[model samples]
Target: MKWGLLGGTFDPIHMGHLRCAEEIREIFELNRIVFIPASKSPHKLDAEITSFYHRAQMVRLAIEGNPSFSFSDVEHQRAGKSYSIETVEYFLNKYLKSIEIYFILGQDAFQAIQTWKEWQKLLLLCNFAVLTRPGYENMGLSGALPEEFSAQFTYDEKTSGYRGPTGHHIYFRKVTFLDISSSDIRSRVRHGKSITYLTPDPVRHYIQKNNLFQMD
Candidate 1:
């Protein structure tokens, strides 16, 4: 079976997250896409993150009806900072190397992957489907990729993707860019602005009921 793993803080899951996962599932013919909300992010350690319970619940609500979509709390269950390499390894062990795992991430995250823990090993472990943002559709390795790993990928013009040294490919998928962001939603809510369409109705209600992100 082929699976896609999308991990994030998911302070509050929104439409943008759902849309990206949906598009990738259809485009790649994936069996299922698991949305794993991180307990804590190493990159955003200083940033104020919502509790894991709320983040996980919001993810569950965001992907309730889709049979192909599911949520996992693997990171939450584990201790310490959530790292992609560890998560990928866990999935590999749990699936016993029988499934093809694709790590789904945005272009920004893809570009900063060099800073991640065991990034080289992570690249060799699974395929990457980086969702390209608007205006970054034609981006190449020179500016996007780190200097050290530039030679690792050989560009294939026919497919507009990059093949790694190992057989795993980094597929840069051009997604329909949504102007919405989790931080922006939080800011709006903090100022008492309506976040009706920014996130799902259920999620909005939960936030309101709990009074989350509201300024003191």
Candidate 2:
């Protein structure tokens, strides 16, 4: 049971988000990928995030017809600011019988793991699948591997290829870089700019119809 966890605020799910999930699933032979929209993201506290219902609905719309992709409201159900380590632990405890979780994150996010709460314990609970854009090859663990988990680090280029399961190994997958961002999309909508390609067409329509992101 290899499951991929793709967590984000998902202000509105976009093409890059979908592509990343599809490519990763194909490349890693993942059984399924769960899109977990944060109820309250700890990192983006200053940003004006959409409601949990809106974000979760957008994720549901984005992954609609894909059997291999699904949405989870675990983070939304939890109290306080969302933390990756706590979310991973929730899955571990709930699916203790046959669960193997792989948390997927972008290179930029992965670089900031040192500052996350209980980050060291997270590595032991689930493997990390770091998604890198164009020029980020030399992007793995550095400095030190905590105190007791030094030998757990392993590198393999084959895991980046578009076949076979990466299993429980931590890896970096190089992907086509798209500079599209949720923040930019929100701003565009606020300024009456077209965000057609930046997000899914339906999601764009939803935003416009609901008059979201518009501010004085």
Candidate 3:
């Protein structure tokens, strides 16, 4: 089985998030796409993230009707910083060992892989699926990859992805451009700006109903 793992804070799930999942499902012929909302992201420590319950609920609403899409509370269930290596290990152990796991990420996030907990070990667990963000693809080797980990990558234009074996295997899938960001959405909401197209209608309504992001 081929599964795509898209993990994020998902403070409030948005259209870009949904679109990216859909696009990747088709592009990679994935059997399922699991949306994993981080309990606490190791990165972005300054941002005021919503509670795990709220974030998980928003993700549930966003992917409700899609059979191919599902939610995982793996990070939330596990204490401490949400690390990809741990999350991937959980699925590998609980689910089918023969399954192919693709860890989905944006180009910007992909560039910062070395900063993640057990970053090198994460590559050995699952393949990476990177979405093309504005100005990210233009970054050369130094910009796209870490100096110490450059030797691990093997590019394949046919799949628009990268592959490397580290005990297991990791793949980097280049996807369609989607500029949507949770930060932009949160900022708009905080400033009382319209977020109509930025997020899903249900999520927008949920945020408004709960009065989230209304802080001064």
State every prediction's TM-score relative to the real structure. Answer: 0.94, 0.88, 0.88
Candidate 1: lDDT of 146?
A: 73
Kindly give the stretch of ten consecutive residues in candidate 3 with the minimal lDDT sum: 165-174
Give one digit per residue, the lDDT tens place, for model 1 in 1-216. Answer: 999999998878888999999999988899999999988899999998889998888889889899999988999889999998999999999989898998999988877788999988898788899998975554666666676776888888876677788877788887777778999999999998999999999999999988898887
lDDT tens digits, residue span 11-104, model 2 = 8778888898888888778999999998888888997778888888778877888999998999988889999988998888898837778789
Better of 1 and 3 by lDDT: 1
Pairs that collide, model 3: 127-171, 128-171
The digit string of per-residue lDDT tens for model 3 on 1-216 reads: 999999998877888889989998998899999999999788867777888988988899889899999999999899888888999999999986777898888877878777888877777677777676667664533576676675666655555445564533344445565677788888899898999988878888889998887776
Lowest lDDT block of 10, candidate 1: 135-144
Best candidate (score: TM-score): 1
Q: lDDT for every model?
A: 0.88, 0.79, 0.80
Task: Report model 3's TM-score to 2 decimal places.
Answer: 0.88
Cα RMSD, model 2:
3.5
Using lDDT, rank the candidates from best to worst: 1, 3, 2
